[model samples]
Target: MKEKGFRYSILASGSSGNSFYLETGEKKILVDAGLSGKKISQLLAEIDRQPEDLDAIFITHEHSDHIQGVGVLARKYQLDVYANQKTWQVIDQQNLIGKLALEQKHVFECGKLMTLGDLDIESFAVSHDAVAPQFYRFIKDDKSFVMLTDTGYVSDRMSDLLANADGYLIESNHDVDILRAGSYPWATKQRILSDKGHLSNEDGADSMLRTMGQKTKRIYLGHLSKENNIKELAHMTMTNHLLKADIGVGQEVKIYDTSPDNATPLVTI
Candidate 1:
């Protein structure tokens, strides 16, 4: 049988910015708009989508790398922007971002399920330093999809929570050894290794192994560190660990790396 409706594209992902386009065959939504407004618009056009075509924009947290273009996107598209109350408060307190219209504001509580078009979307809390760090779980036609980024470590509960996704975009931020020896300051290193910081490549790969099932077919490694991790290193780390665990990546799962400067090709699930 043909796969039911789902298509995903990562526009940009890294310390610089992050965003994605998710379509449920009927509905199109942006997970985040971290790059500049003009940049995001151009990226959308690259994929044959326009700002006005979005159903909504969901903000994962208040970090500048995730919210830099949120206000600008909302203003331009008059798009519905959803975030947890705490994240909204934090974003509003920062005047660097442009203004969003009153009608465009929407608040969502973590773990509370909501819907956009035919897809059921649930935002769950994640271990990140942001005030209300969360990631999404979207279900459509019984197919589960998730996008997790900027997470420090994976908890057992989180692993179980994410299992059986048809597609997942998970953060593999850095290599622990490289990060330790890298030029970033000691304090910065500590933060990246902290429970509430970013996920090391090992941690990310292990989470994938734990959570993946036959239904879990597509894995996109995202939010890699520029200073501490290269794309080849991150990809190799994940593939090697999976092979050691007797889970062959190319056999039952397909893996890809997200881009820091461009959009990945749209892959339909």
Candidate 2:
């Protein structure tokens, strides 16, 4: 019998690497594969999936923390990989990712829509340092799911495009005061706070408040910085924000702090 609903889980999330396992009854895809192929394979195994079972990979950008395992997974499994033209160009130009077969290479422009099995996928531009950074929204059978991370901010334009999702995995990357006081060099710190840098916990909480709707059922905070953001801090930050808005985390929406090292509980829609 086919699975009755859609489901997803964050396999691993952090600056070290990022990957998600997303599946409908008919399809299984990875949003990114930044970790080593071996690690990604093991993570998949934890969820009872094998690397060879993936239908495709949707590359958010060419950052090493997002695409490091692309080559290995694709070559090993003969899976299709999709990214925008600029991302493909840079990955090839910098020799960053592995050599993918021509047949396996696919490109989808920003603002365009594509269908995989029964799901419709859409990508939107985001503020990030890498070339052609984008996040995705997946819809199937009246359900909408999103993975919006690695961006400095989620703009109003994009928020409207993504509002009312059934589930969201958004970034809560750092704490402003913590990031400012940490031991990192000034330049690197500034880069993380720049218009194209990662979002702080405060900004992330605000993003959730703005985009979350009555229909939104869950929020998984992801991509936390190991040095600057504590798991409890991110959790409370978002919880307090929702509380102020009269949106209870457990009552109205489920919120989870995703681990950088382990897989989150499988959330099925």
Candidate 3:
């Protein structure tokens, strides 16, 4: 029997690497390829999927943390890569080295809608240090999902784009108090706290609250720092704020965390 809903999984997530798998009955798409091709293959194997099952990759930006394995995955697996023109320039200048070109890498402009296999994708600009960082809204049949990570701040524009998503993967990068007392260098600390750096727990919670509604099903917090925040604290911070807004946990919506080292179970719609 065919499954009633779309399926999504975080192959791995963190500063070391980031990758996600999404399947909509007939089509499969990977959101990012941060891990090595070998590691990615292993992760897929753990979930009973093969590398060849992937249809394409949607890059949020050109950051090493998100594209570390992109070139290798695309070249070896012949997976189509999609991103904006600026991302392409940055990707091209980077040391792809001996990695396979795969073929002409596909390009799509931010704020435009496109079709990938049987799924629909809408790209939007997001705040970050990388060239043309973007967030994605994906639709398949009647289900809608969004992936908005690597963003420094939440904006009205981003809120509008993510509104009413059935599933969301958003960045919750740090805890403010922890970041203030952490031992990192002053310059690096400043960058992380800046508007173009990373999202704080509060920032992430606020964005979720803005998009919270009866229809939103799941929210997976992503890209948390190893040094500055603890998983429980990050979850509590967002949880408390959302509760104050009268968003009941496991009632109106479900919240999840993506570990920095490995994959989470497939989050289905």
Candidate 4:
């Protein structure tokens, strides 16, 4: 029998690596495969899934933390990989994930909708440092989930595109104060705080306030920097913002934290 609802899990999320798993009863897919194949497989096992069960992998960019295990997983499972042409080009140029079979390489245009099994998937461009970093939205029936991470800032268009999602896996990469005072070099800090860099917790909170609606109840704060942000801080940052907007956390919306080493519990909507 087919599953009755959409379900997903953040297999791993952070600067060290990133990956997400989603299933629509008939199809199982991974959004990124940044960790080693063995590590990804182990994470999958925690969720009662196997790497071989994936039908495809959708790449967001050529960053090593997002595509590290893509080659191995795709080659081992003969799974298709989808990415924008520019991202594909850099991935190939850098040999980031190693060789992928011609058949397994699939180029998708951003801002276009593609259907896969029971879901409708769409990718939209984001303000990130990478050549072609885009975030994704997945719709199954009336339930929609937005995966918006790695972006330095959320544009107005992105905010509009993500409104009223049922769930969001958004980046709350760092705290501005914490990042500004961290041990990193000045240039690195500046890069991280740039328009093409990762979003600060304040930026993320504001973005959520702009995009979240009555239908948006669940949010998974992702891509937190261990050097600059704490899990509790990210959660509190969003929670406090929501409260100020007269939105109830846990009552009206539930916020979850994702980890670099652990898989979040399976979330269904």
Error of 2 at 109 (Å): 0.9
Please tell me which model should have the higher lDDT, number 1 or number 2.
Answer: 2
What ranges in model 4 sit over 4 Å off?
none
Name every residue pair that clashes in candidate 4. 152-197
For model 3 the local lDDT of residue 34 reads 82
Across residues 95-201, which tens digit of lDDT does each residue of candidate 1 receive? 64567777888998998899887788999999899898988988878888888888888788988888888988888999888999999999999998998899888
TM-score of each: 0.96, 0.98, 0.94, 0.98
Worst 10 residues of 1 by lDDT: 93-102
Q: Rate the local accuracy (lDDT) of all candidates.
A: 0.86, 0.90, 0.81, 0.92
lDDT of 2 by residue, 31-126 (tens): 999999999988888788888878999999999999889899999998899999999999999988868789999998899999999779999999
Q: In order, what is each prediction's RMSD in angstroms?
A: 1.7, 1.1, 1.7, 0.9
Give me candidate 4's TM-score against the actual structure.
0.98
Q: Which candidate ranks first by lDDT, i.e. highest? A: 4
Task: State the lDDT at 126 in candidate 2.
Answer: 93
Q: Show model 1 residue runs off by greater than 4 Å.
A: 1-3
Model 4, 21-128: lDDT tens digits are 999878999999999999999999998999998999999988899999999999999999999999999989888888888989999889989999888999999888
Candidate 4 accuracy as lDDT: 0.92
Q: After superposition, how far is residue 231 of candidate 1 from its true place, in Å?
A: 0.8
